[model samples]
Structure formats: C-alpha cells, structure tokens
Target chain A: MRDILTIEAVEKKATRDGFGQGFHEVAQSNSDVVGLCADLVGSLKMQAFIKEFPERFFQVGIAEANMMGIAAGLAIGGKIPYACTFANFATGRVYDQIRQSIAYSHKNVKICASHAGVTLGEDGATHQILEDIGLMKMLPGFTVINPCDAQQTREAAIAIADHDGPCYLRFGRPGWPMFTETGSFKIGKAIQFSEGSDVSIFATGHLMWHAVEASKKLVQEGITVDLYNFHTIKPLDEEAILESIAKTGCVVTAEEHQRNGGLGDSVAQTIIRHNPVPMEYVAVNDSFGESGKPAQLLTKYGLGIDDVYAAAKRALTRK
Target chain B: MADIAELKRIASQVRRDIIRQVHAVSSGHPGGSLGCTDFMVALYFAVMNHQQSFNMDGANEDVFFLSNGHISPLWYSVLARSGYFPVKELSTFRKLDSRLQGHPATHEGLPGVRVASGSLGQGISVAIGVALSKKLKGDTQTVFVLTGDGELQEGQIWEAALYAPHNKVDNLVVTVDWNGQQIDGANDDVLSLGDLEAKWIAFGWDVMHMNGNDMEEVVNVLNEAKDKTGNGKPICILMKTEMGMGVDFMTGTHAWHGKAPNDELAEKALGQLEETLGDY
Candidate 1:
C-alpha cells in the first residue's frame, strides 16, 4: 500500500461530507436505513439524504437526549437510524440516554458524530470534544470508528450500516486531503501502509495525513517506518498491532485526541498485555483545546507532523 | 361492554403478585407498582392488541413502555399474568440471574420490555421513536408509555414532550402516573411538578385526565386514548393515583416507595387484597 501514501491529492473534503454522501447512498439501497438529526441537517451534511428520503428523515430539534432515545426506539422498530449531531452532544450530553436506551438495551443505533476533537476549531473547548472516543469506546458492545479521510469516512459509514449492533462513527469538521482508497474499509482491521523494522507508527483520524508526511521525511533520514491506520478503536486489531510491534520493537501513536483515552491508550493497553515495547504518544496532553485554526490547534496540542516525527525519534532512542 | 368484575379480579391478583414478588426479594419498588397496578392491568388485559408471544418489533400491534422502571414488580406481574412469560417467573423478581431485573430491561431477553429504563426521562423519547417508525411503515398500531409524575421532572421528558406534538407523532399515548409522590416525599415536598395538566396542554399535546386507581376509569380512558390516535396531534393522559393505593398502611404516603414490607407486614398487606389467581 506504498502507492496510497504516494498519491499527491489535489482534492480535499471534510470527513463529515463523506459521511453525508455515504449515508445517502446506503439509504437508497436499504429502506430500513433512517436519518435523525438534532437541528444540524446542514452541518452534518444530511441535506441530500433528507431531500431524497424525507419520509425516512426525523428532525428532532436540538434535543440530543430525545434524539438518542428515538434512535434506540427506531432500532427497536427495525430501522437502522443514524442519529447525527456534534460529537460532544452525541456522547457526553446524553450519556445516560445512550447508556440505558441504546447500549444496555442492545439497540442497533448508529451514533454518527461530526466535528470531533481539537480539529473542530473556532468553536473552542466547549464545542470541540477531545474525550468522545474514550466515552463511546467505554460503552459495552459499541463499535467505535474514527476514519482518516473523506473517502474512508464514506466507506466506513456504508460498511457500518451493514454491520449490525450499536456503533459510534466519529468524523471531523475541517477539510483534509483525500488519500485512502475508496471501498477498502473493513471494521476492526488496521491498514498496513508500509513494512519496516525500525519503528512502528500507529495513527487514526485526521492525524494519519500528518503521520504519512512525517514518515516520508523519516524514510529519507534512513529510518524504516512501519505504519498502520487504526480506524476501529474498540475490538482493536490486536493481531496486527502485535505483528508490527514484534517486527519494529518500538511504537509511536498519533491522533487528534486526548492522550488519556483515545487511540494512544488503546494501543498501550494492547502492548502492555502481550509485549512491553518502548512507546511514545503524539496527542493532546491532558488539556482542553482552544479556539484557533485547525492546523494551529494541532501544532499547539502537539499533534503536528513534526510531533509525530519527534515521537518516533523518541521511541527509537528508547528501543 | 367490558367485564368490570373480571378486570377487578385480575387487578387484585396482579396486586397480590406485586406484593409477593417484592416481599420475596426483600427489595424492589412496591409503592408506584401498587399505585399503577390498575392502569397496567387494564392496559394489558383490556386495552392493547399485543401478542403474548413477544418479539422486539411489535408491528401492527400496540406496544407499551414503563418509563418509571423502578416499579418492575408491577410490570413483571402484569406481563406474567398476560402470558408474556411464565407466571412462575414472578418468584424470580430481582433474584440472581433472573430475567426480572430491578428495572425493566431487555438485557435478559425479557419478552415484554423493549428497552431498559431506570434512568428517568428517556422512555418517552423511545416511545416516540417507535411511534414514528410505525408511521413510516404505515402501521396503524399505537405506542403507549408510562412515566412517573416525578419522572417528568427530568429535562429529557420535556424535550420529548416538545418533540412529539411538533412532529405530529399522533400514534403515541403517554400516561403520567401522577402519584404526587416520589422517594423523598410528596412531589410537592421534593420538587413541585407545578400544574401538570396545564403543562401538557401548554406543550401542545392533546391532554386528557383520569383516576389511575379506578379500574373502570383506567380501561375507559386507555380506550379513549386509543380512539384519539391518528389525529394531527399526540395524546397525553394525566393519570391521578395514590402513592400506595390498596394496602391501608401503605396508602396515602410515599414511605413505601422503595422499601419492601417485612414478613408480618406482608401478611397484613396480603389480607386486604384477595388472591383471585393462584400465587406463583
């Protein structure tokens, strides 16, 4: 999959747009697929789907709790309801609603969240959610997904629609380069970008683009970088993680999320269980993000391309 | 043309089952369960066109949700008497590994319950979702939900209350168990509900009122609520019930809300109500 990183992309799109297109496409094929939004029809990019399937769409006002309960109810009624809202409102605001109605009840509702993490920008700490992945992944029987780019987010949306049970699909607000191949999405399976023996790099969400950029520069410096994209956080691909770590003997995890409960912690838990490896995390260090440009937020939060490069170097030294 | 005598007999047996189940466990909410017994028994036996053999999707048939789920004893008794599960499972209320949890849940594959509800304020939203689903599929069946008057204090209840009528979710009936009592004390003492009837009317629902403890009234009002369905607006029934209705000692107070009666007290409570059906 080296060609995946080599493709110089001229097109850019937000992952939420991919979700909109993918959701609309799936709704066409399956009549059971329904859409529910909490007054974010445009922000979540669900206009086309709402226009085409007005009968299947439900506008639940700004009530996130009701939206979650309705999604669970729709699931009980045998409809695949995609309950859409900002990541903060989707997870934290209505945690009890989700815990009882959807997760504990074992309802098949897809909580499609957008504008996740520091990359949300401008809206600042209250709107930007850094702990969503941890909150959702902690719930029992929830499929947690944080796809890299637009094409992959779209593909993830379509794939999860067919995969039964409750899932949390987290995407972002800002536009990022479209690099991952379309229709190559698989749940709970990591994509190996390149094979090497120096240091293994694990990245998810918007950070994958930066990981790719940092890997190119590292390879030119004669470091063999073993890279993998972890889209699914829960039911993590431990087999792939162990295989890469065994080959490289060290690891660096990158994501536009808090270091506490996001992909970094997931990988650390896996490594501690099977093999103890020297690891470094390139993530927001136990801090709430502020209003800034997406790129500037990444730099301030220690999630830039240079951050990944520096983490990789730190892991190599420990090895 | 309903048998008021027979429904009364069933309600008595359901009340017996509720007391016995809670007494066996030494824990469970018996107050609201006792208070709402007539309404639930009337709904299951005389009101809903439900299948005794339960499925997740209650298509083409009326479905019910108990939003005030601490009263699992009441629902378990009614569901068992209605043949959703064996009547013997009434003995398993709150026991280890039993299908009957302290709160109504689908986790143990309990046939009648569609979702877990112990955390208040979510069940109304869930019922709305099912009602919307039925509307989408052109199914003519109605969705019913019961929440404690105290449960309405939850913000999510108002959120759903605002949503149902605005979206024209007409195939739904929500009945508030207006017992005026919560765990702390009277609702007035804990947190004033402040004119529930006017509140439902102000929220744009087609509101109705009934005495929940009266078996005849419960049956008639539920049938009336069913008749009101398929209109341009959703329906809400503000049901007035005593916190503890039947047993003389437990009645007129909120003290019995979550406490199970001791053996002697259980015997006294059972004496006031006849065992119209054999005990499990």
Candidate 2:
C-alpha cells in the first residue's frame, strides 16, 4: 500500500485518464490488441490507444451494435479487441449484440464502458446507466469488472486482454479519487484498504474512494472499519469477502450504481449464501438520476462519502 | 459421381433423423428443418472443406453458423452423422442436461456450435464477426450463415446488412431460408419484407436466388457464391425453399412449423423420404 492521500489530493486524478494511459501502454506491447469505438473515442479517453495503434483501431461511427459485432469478429481472428463506448450505449442499447456475438460465442472481447452512473455529471437520465452491472453480470461467462480509480482502470484495461472470455469493464468519466499506486492490477482479488472488526465496507469503482474516506471518518468517531475494493464483480473474490465478514460481524456495500442489482446486491447475495451476515447497501435507491454536478448528484442520491459512513455505522449497529 | 448419389442417400437418412428427433421430443420446428435438410446435407458433406476433428477457432477450415437455430435438429443430425458428435446423443434432444439444447448453444460444450442462437436475427452479425476475424488473421476460409426469411424482419439483420458491404466483408456467404411461412403464418402475413432480394441488392451485396430444396441448385448457387468471394462484396443467397419439401401432408403448411408428428404422421413422412443411410 502506498501513502494514503487526503480526499482532496486523491480527487485530482480521473479514472478515464488511467484507462487512456493503460490502453496506450498495452497497445505498445501487443500488436494484435485492437481498439473499437462507437463514436466515443475522445469521451471514453480511447483516443490515446487510437493514436498509438492507428491501423489496429476501428472507428465504428455511431453504430454500437456494429461495433460489438466487429469486435467479436476481431476476437475470432485472434485479435484482442477493446470496445470503448459510453456505459448507456455499451450495455443497454446493444445488449442483444453483446449477448449473442460476444458472450454466447465466448469471444475474447473487452467491452470497456465509461461514464457509468450519475457521476457522468449533467448528461442526464439518457446518458447515465445505473443498470449496466446487472445487465453485464446476467450474461453467462461474461466477466464484469469495475475498477476503483484511474490506477485500477489502467490496470484492468491491461489485464483484461489476457482473460480469454468476454469482459465488461465499467469505469466513470469524471475525475475521482486516485488511491492506488501505479502498478499491475490483479482481477478478482479484493484489495483491503483498512482492517477492522466492527463492520466491513465493500466498495467498487469510483465509490471505493468514498468508502475509504468514510472508513477514516468512522475510525476517528471510535468505530473500527474494514474496507475492501471489489474490482471484479463477476468472478467475485468470495474468499476475501467471507474472510472479512468472518472477522467483522456485519457488512456495508458501496457503489455508484442502482441498489437493486449493483455491487451491494451481489455482495448481499454472496454473504447470504456463503456466510450469512447483516448487510446494508449505500447506493442510488432504485431511482434514475437527473442532470446535476457529479458531486451534488452523489450527495443527493445517497452515494456520497457520508452515506457510506452512515451505512457502515448502521451495519455495525445491526450486530 | 457415386459420392453424389451416396450423399443424397445420406441426406435422406438425415431427413429421417430430423423427423424422428422432432417426433421423439414431441416439440421442435420440423417444417423448416425438413425443408432445409438437403441444403444442410449438401453443405456439410459436399460444400464445406473442413477437418475431421472440429476446432472452434476454425482458423484452417470453413465455418458455418445456423442463425435460425430452430432448425437445430437438422444441424445436429448433420453434425453427428458427419462425425462432429456421437449419433446416440440425438435421443437426448430437449431433455434436461442434454447438449442438444432447445436452441444451439456452445454452453453445453457441444462440438461444431460456435455460439448460442435461440434469439432470432443475431447469427448473421456473429458470422460477420467471424468473417472479419478470418480477414484480420489472413485466413482464407469462408464463413457461411443461414437465416430465416421471417428473421430478416429484425433490425439487427439490417444493421449487419449495411455493415458487411461497408466493411468489404467479401468472405461471408449469408443464405436466407425464404420459405415464406413462420410460426404464426406466412412471412408476408406476419410482416411483409417488401422486396427482400432488392433489399439485399440495394445494401451493396452480390445477391443470387436458388431453389434450396434441390441439391444440384444449392450446389450450383453455392459454387457461384464461392467464385464471387474476394470481390469487395458479401454474398447473399436468397434460397427459395418450400416450407416442407419431402412430406406431402406437411408441405406448404404453417401448422407444422413447430408441431411434431404422431406415429401415423411420422410413418407417412418416412414413406415419402427413404432412409438411404441407417437411422440413429
């Protein structure tokens, strides 16, 4: 673990930038690695990979369905295709395409989605996709990954290509906390931020930074908190979750997604089946987001750092 | 050649298997499966140059995808008889824990099935992807996809149609089973696909029409498709096949779209088509 930064310092770096940097780095090593964009190259920060691997990159224009098919086809020809598009377009618009051409075919395709959740900031309900995790996870053999920050997103982009099956890597557009140090990322391994006995805070994607901040706040208020970043949602680190729950009697899940089928529900389901534990979810409570600043939306939707802190306290009180 | 007659005999056996498999399960789309039997038999046996051992990557051999997967009975029979799997596995059609799923899927690890296709109008897009993969790898093998006329109503099919031409996907041969009838009624009744041939031609594809029930016509049109490959345009074969070709009672009827035959009906169907090869 590197130096734990203050919330202000961590908030300076964007996760999409990490994705862009990592994408370009991976393209340098692997010639067969290709990038496909559905007219969202600049927004998703995939222009770096496009610039680095011009011949290998494919600009599919606004046709997301065609982009998915082409990416699947590229995978069939021994090419590792990273398909970049907004979260709304990647999962919701072209779900049938991903289901049949990529997941069902078991193609080695990476669906790297950016601008996930209300954190997309002022893009409104049409751009924000709170149901992407549920949609991607329901697909059999599709690996779903939501990295914490820029560092984790970069690591996930480089690591997902080595994975043989279809993957949905969800990241956000706005700049968030960057806690992880620059290094290689391991998929399906829960990174523990703080070890405590009262309650476990399992967070994913941009919400991990908030969870860490909440954990620090809880510690000062005489509460011992355990925080874990669940980067991979599909092949979830069940052992890590079970181990944390065994130590802490209760759990609190945090994510910038819908409360129904996002990280909270996934963790709750696992805990109930494997190790029954009292759990609370800190997420947008089954509502579509509105146009606003990302920070304001997070606070309004009960997904801010304060919500995670409250959920941790409530979960701890449950035991 | 003697093989041509032998292949026809084998096709008869495959048709018997299709009827038997559908009848045994008491549920399956037999009309289209029976109608496309000769074309499938000719494709797997005479047309595609593949390896004895099946590989999903299909880097060195021709690849085929059944987009309208309701005809899995015919494809499974052809694959089993063609040595992709055991003939005995045909009995487990639609049964629990069987590789022969209601739709063709790779989930059960069934050989020769590259993707899942119970969902209509997704196979051509997948086939295009596979075709694109072949192009990227410098693999000279062609990809063949078969879709139903009714399935062409899906928007994704048009999405794929517009894409194949724009991308110069010349190694793909998409065949539409223009048999007119679907589950509800004729394709014209369900949803009129106005000028389907003209639609493909306008989409910048090299289009050809053939009688799919006739093995010779299928072979000729497919050969023409092969010759037309690598010409900067995808090939579309609008195969005009009957709803049911072999059995007189089931012919030109939408009632048999998914209805299995009773013992008497099965006997009558068997009477029309000879079991040239041994039944499973």
Q: Choose the strongest candidate by TM-score.
A: 1
Best by lDDT: 1
Q: Can you tell me the CAPRI class of model 2?
A: medium
| RMSD of each predicted structure | 1.0, 2.1
Clashing pairs in 2: A73-B129
lDDT of each: 0.92, 0.86
Give the C-alpha miss distance for residue A221 in model 1, angstroms. 1.0
Q: Tell me how far the alpha carbon of residue A170 in candidate 1 is from the true structure, in angstroms, after superposition.
A: 0.3
lDDT of 1 by residue, B1-280 (tens): 5788999999898889989999998998989999999999899999999987898989989999999999989999999999989999988889899999999899899989999999998899999999988988899999999999889889999999999989899999999999899999889988999988888999999999999999999899999999999998999999999977889999978899999999999999999999998888
Candidate 1 per-residue C-alpha lDDT over A246-276 given as tens digits, one digit per residue, 9 for 90 to 100 = 9999999999888889999999999999999
Candidate 2 C-alpha lDDT tens digits along A182-228: 56368888887777888899999888889888888888887877778
Give the Cα error of residue A142 in candidate 2, in Å: 2.6
The TM-score obtained for chain B by all candidates, in the order given, is 0.99, 0.97
Lowest lDDT 10-mer window, candidate 1 chain A?
A1-10
Best by DockQ: 1
